[model samples]
Target: MKVLLHVSHLVQWDIALSNSKNLKAIEAKSKIEIVVNAHAIQLYRELSENLLQQLNELENLNIKVKLCRNALRNNNIEESTLPATVEIVPAGIFEIIKKQEEGYYYVSP
Candidate 1:
């Protein structure tokens, strides 16, 4: 199973973290992708050091993280400035659509 997590607000960080726990607990083969856009881009900036470390660890667990280029542009952040774990996509909405079409289950978490 594949899951696409849509993150667009700061409040969703908790949702994402909880979802990560659930996903990791599963025994079945599954893929988790977390996409960040809009105000959620700042979510990373606000993360506590421990949480940030945990987020980086998600990559090791095979949970992918993505950030929208347009969102970064709006915030005046350079794509190159993002952490190595997060992928920079052209657009968040488009990426969501593409993932959906590819059979990923979409979740706001």
Candidate 2:
């Protein structure tokens, strides 16, 4: 099973990270893809040094973190500030819809 995580809130990173850490707990799990937007982007960017290290570890675990291009533009966040692994999606909501249409389980955290 593929999971599409929609991260719209900053504090939800705790849940997202916890879920990522326990991926095997999911009833039917194969691949996990995380799509982040809104304030989550800023939180990821402003993570503490230790938290950043944890995020890097998560990245190595094959979690794909995506940022919404529209949100970045609206918030005046420069793309360069984001980690290189973070992809810019055209629209966060649209991305969620597309992922669901493609059979990914959508979760908001």
* Clashing residue pair totals per candidate (backbone < 3 A): 0, 0
Expressed as tens digits, the lDDT of each residue in 1-109 for candidate 2 is 7888888887887788788778745643467777878877676556478766866877777787778998888777888876676788999889989989999998887
* Candidate 2 worst ten-residue window by lDDT: 24-33
The whole-model lDDT of each prediction reads 0.83, 0.78
| Candidate 2 backbone collisions, by pair | none
Native-referenced Cα lDDT, model 2: 0.78
TM-score of each: 0.89, 0.84
Positional deviation of residue 106's Cα in model 2 after best superposition, in angstroms: 1.0
Q: Candidate 1: TM-score? A: 0.89
lDDT of 2 at 74: 76
Question: Mind giving the per-residue lDDT tens digits that candidate 1 earns over 1-109?
Answer: 8999999997996788678768878843688888899998876554468766866778777888888888888887866655777788999999999999999999996
